[model samples]
Target: MRTQTTPPAAPPVRATGRPGRALPLAAVLLAVFVVPMSISGTAVALPGIGADTQAGLAPLQWVVNAFNVAFACFTLVWGSVADIVGRVRAFAAGAAVYAVASAASALATDVLWLDGARALAGIGGAAIFSCGAAIIATAFDGPARARAFALFGTVAGVGVALGPSLAGLLVQGLGWRWVFAVHAAALLLVLLAVPAVAGAVPADGGSGARLDLPGSALFVVAMVLLTTAIVQGSQWGWVSPGVLGLFAAALAVLAVFAVVEDRREHPMLDLSVLRDRRFVGLCLVPVAASFGFVTLLSHLPSYLTAAAGRDTAAAGLIMLLLTAPVLICPMLAAKLVTRGIPALTLIHVSLGCLVVGDLALTLFSPDVKILAVALPMLVTGAGMGLSAGLVDGQALELIDPAKAGMAAGFLNTLRLGSEAIAVAVYGSALATALGTRVDNGIGDHAGASHADLVAARAAGGDLARAAELSGAVDTEGFVRFLARSYDSAFHTVLWGLAAVCAVLCAVIAVLLRGGSGRNSRPAPAGNSPGDRGV
Candidate 1:
């Protein structure tokens, strides 16, 4: 008998119609923009929302964090679900849900209602975001894919940069509720784009994988507990039972998740991915970079307005300087990357700039000009742009194409998880620092009050003498003292973040060999088995 030989399967066909090709990319970009914009845009309106609804600081924190926590927890599951079911279907469902949730938020009567709506929005956002890169991956190949990724990055950068300034305008012109209402309009655009894209792509015909139910539950529990502890720890005290219990629960659940995933045949996250030294190194950059980036973004607006005593609108405009670099740098970075510049180099450069930016801001005195404040922001933005795409690209490079969905899911999960932790951790740090400064100022004033009382008593308790003694007290001193104290506290937090950025840069330097060296290896025939088109 003759020996039989079999040919390899052909590469999967890519959809090519104009509507089919363009719609998914448009939908994904729009959806991505909405998520960050919604958070940043509404930030300017928080005081108004709080006063209107009589919500406390804790509730206000949840208004922002609920969406982040939900999105972070559900991202991987939804990404996997999109791969299993069909990307178009998943995208549509998420868009619809997000739209409704935005409307619900606009109409919310109380903090609980608004928070629930935000959580639902997060679920919807996860579904859309989880599949975003995969959709781009499937739609374009090679250089086209790189360009698409760059364009997507640019859109995200613009949205984030514009969100706060836009919100400030809206809050001044319309009302706080309109911020949520605007998202509803954006969602409608996504809804229209989804069907156009779905029509072009072939339906997902592969076997639907089992939902990682146990893993999903544990991940959600871990994230919620971790976020809760960070946000509430300052209020409740770090060692309070509520905070400690939450932290303990988060760790225990996460530990269980690792063991469960390691043993499962169809794990949500492939543990082997972590073993890739190069990939692991790239991942750490995002964790550290995000922590530092968020620390600046979260606190800078308040610093500009309150510490600098600028008008809110002026502060919002100053924030634009920070965002402008995010928009501009990615296009430049993409060109450099394609010219065979190492991704690791870009990562290091970005982190280094972040450190410099944070240090600059920390050294900002009350007399520092707005331009001085804006300079650090520009440096930070460039760093962010350089590091933004490294994690996803590196993760995809390590895994087989068949496991692209899972890898994408895991990468997003890590990114979102890092973001959530960054916000919580940095927010706690700022709050603690500010509180201590305020307390010390109040303590120093106690003696001044005591001296005034003694002077009044020595005057035989005459009302005129008491008034004269009170007038003699240095009231302006207290105002200046409070301002100086706040400045010191703000600087302390920025310096701490600068230290974080330095550590991150060091870690990336140690772990990542130059991408240029890796690219010099000969290209494989056809697509590399591990390479997805995007």
Candidate 2:
């Protein structure tokens, strides 16, 4: 008689061969980290920039949107270029461009100059992000690949989580300019390290790769017009000809792109990716998650300042409760994936937790303790952690490895585009909620318009200014009314968005039940489970 025990599974092998193995990963992380850092940090510095430049709300909004618009429009183009020109070259060049732009931005005295610099920075960011993902994908495999992606994703989250707090310190210690200045210095270091760390890879440009100029033009025009309409809708009137026209133009351009892409021999955006439902589900993950995260980033700091009576730094610290999970959770999720747990299951659970977290936040009132305000954010943060690299990992898994850069670009486009729309949609929702309250509470209030109320809110609900515009008899009474109305709007939007996330989770859960599609299992480069992307 012999007693036999099964041996433990062997650890997955790591990919090797490069100028320096760790250099590629470091460059990727640096690129990923800086983009989100710049985006999120800028959010914190908006007030400071406004104070310094004496810019109005419209100009300040442009300062933020300029970066987004450029990032959204050109990311795909850069991704394609990365594949053709070589990842390292594209990445290093992008970092240099970003550094120069950051330096210029730091010196900007006027809002227009700052906005232009930010837009240039966004183009550079697009290059870094698109190439960075491809470099990581090509540089690693199996469990190591998962870990690399996890770290990459974690750094992105960490950048966002740390951005506000870090920016607060820089703005407080030095000035708003120092925020961009520090970024410039860091990027310069990345540039100097690039040559030594990034090994050469042959350009894949000879693969009959043709740039889809028409497709690119159409998409850029659509995105620019659509984003402009959404961002300005609350102030400009949603039904105004300008807003309506922009929407129409965007839709028409998108339709043309669809037709052009479908017919093109070498399409910029391969429509084939959309055939897989699971792949589409994975793409939606970032979009849905961002709606919650970006919404908070846009509003929570202001809420903490005006509603909770906290300073900028303290507000950012409080936000750590919501963002800290991002720092640690992705690695944990990767571990779970390595242990044979389904990534989709984790994703569903993550969204469920997010829904719960948002619902919990609705319980918060002006009188609620700080601890109460911070606790629910932990739940949302946890949800974010459990689903860290899931979206990007799954997305890469779905596409051709050679098109890694384009896949990354496409995925990010969806995420960033959703964020742009979410900001506007959320703003509109808040406006609607406030309007309902105003109509009911102060009927026929002189000079009261939806635009005025929203503008008042943008000004942190200044009672005196609102009173001056609306001709309210009692400034204090109006202030209190506005505060309550804003609070209600905040809760309503969160709850509504949470419900939407929950629905998305449900759909994904059903799609993933029993077994995930072909790419369900994580495997090394040579041993991928199936060619059919899940």
Candidate 3:
């Protein structure tokens, strides 16, 4: 007599219930939106925070970098934790932590306190971001997955697009603290609903399922050291003993992380994922976009308010031109993907827009036209919308569906790390260029000494302060000179970024071509349902 064979249980994606997935999707989208919104929104408030707290440029920068460091270091650990416990549990816990962190940030009386709170928020953000997409991926597949992921990306873009405008209103109407307070309140509401919306998923329970504590500790140490060195490099001098030592120490720690992961039964980062060219190419999307466009989101508002003499609200309005496409293009990309248009094609086209956008910014000048700023922003925003919409879904499709939480975490680690590095590199370059130009301008007309010029540059681009330091009688003329210097520095940065994006675009276009577009259609034989099972 023949015995009956049992098939393995269907993947958790099968358990998420199609007929009632909308509530969960909304919940996840709401959760994901908070992360980017908090990031970009806080950027708009930096100037106010600096002035109010009497903080210098370094502390202002730390407010941003601290969050990024925490987010980057802990993202993979959160991803692994989600897999060990449950995605729903992780999501709920993350929401609660994020809300509490926001409240702490709102109550902060000093820059250090705010920085610490923001870092705590980053820890929560890592959990929510890593698990949120995994929950959505578990709930949808094929065309539905494409649409869901596209919507997910779109929501994130909406947050990015709206961040400056919203922050401006909040800061102008209430105060900078209200920005943190409002998000905290909203997150509290979301936390109450997470239990019902996220439902549940299978949890792994075994020794191999345990968290990679050694790997996690090593990674955290390495990332914190790297980010600290990068952020402080300009202030400390790039070649200073302190800066060089930090970099060397970070490298050593990273080497140890690699060795630890290699010997582990289960690593925090599956190094094998690096072997997949398609995954690497998809990650390049965020790297290029963050380097080329996203880092500028925070700085541009400062430029509008300081250099152009606009108020916070006006600066925010001007940003809408750059941010609006983030809302529109992603929905369109989703429709195209549903109609069998390849995601790679959309991403490639978006990359070309990024190149054009950066080139346009390079050509802009305060003497010629102020409106020229919006044109490049529009193009770049379109690129952001189209590329950001697809990268998450396409990248995740290359990995096991059961590991979607970890996959999302890993992808974000690269993406956020790119943003952190871009901000550090670009900010340093801009400061160096601006300082030199300002010194030359001051020396030529203002008759200022090197000491006075140094003080002016250290004033963090405050023309009034710079003028006071130079004791310039023609204050208006001095401000214009400051503006011109800024324009020149911005042009230099944009030119270099444009070239990098153009080259990376060509490489990714080739990498994403033909048979490698595996996620463009349903899974093939090698990637059948059983292959994706836990």
Estimate every model's Cα lDDT from 0 to 1: 0.69, 0.74, 0.75
- Candidate 3 accuracy as TM-score: 0.88
Candidate 3: C-alpha lDDT: 0.75
Local accuracy of candidate 2 as per-residue lDDT tens digits, 1-534: 122222332232233333445665675687789899888789778989999899998889888889999998888777777766677777888899999999999999999999999999999998888888777666655666667778888998888877867888899899999999998988988887776545523332324476778887887888888778877787778999989988998899889888887877666676776665677777777777766666776777666665555676677677778888888889988778777776777778788777788778887676678787677888878877777676677667656666677778887888788888877787788777767776676644544455455444534545446555666666566656666766777788888888877777777666555646333456543453221111
Residue-level lDDT of model 3, residues 1-534, one tens digit each, is: 222222332443544332456666777788788888887778879988988888887788778777888988888788877776777877778888889999998999899999999999999998988888777666566666667777888888888777766888899899899998988887787787775565433342212488888988998899889878887887787889999999999999998888777777667876666666787788788888887778667567666655667776776677788788888888788778766677778888889888888788765554446575777889988888887757888888777765667778888888888887787777777777787787666766655545345433633557666766776667777777777777777778778778878888877776666534555754432233322211
Candidate 1 has its poorest 10 consecutive residues by lDDT at: 454-463
List of clashing residue pairs for candidate 3 = none
Note the residue pairs that clash in candidate 2.
none
Candidate 1: residue 197 lDDT (0-100): 66
On residues 60-172, what C-alpha lDDT tens digit does candidate 1 reach at each position?
87888788878877877777677667776777788888999999999998989999999999898887766776666556544445556677777766776788878878888
**Which runs in model 1 stand beyond 4 Å of their true positions?**
1-20, 199-203, 371-374, 446-473, 514-534
Q: What is the lDDT of residue 84 in candidate 3?
A: 68
From the highest lDDT down, the ranking of the candidates is: 3, 2, 1
**Backbone atom clashes (below 3 Å) for every candidate:** 0, 0, 0
Q: Model 2 residue 151 lDDT?
A: 87
Candidate 2 Cα outliers beyond 4 Å, as residue runs: 1-14, 200-208, 308-314, 371-375, 443-455, 458-475, 510-534
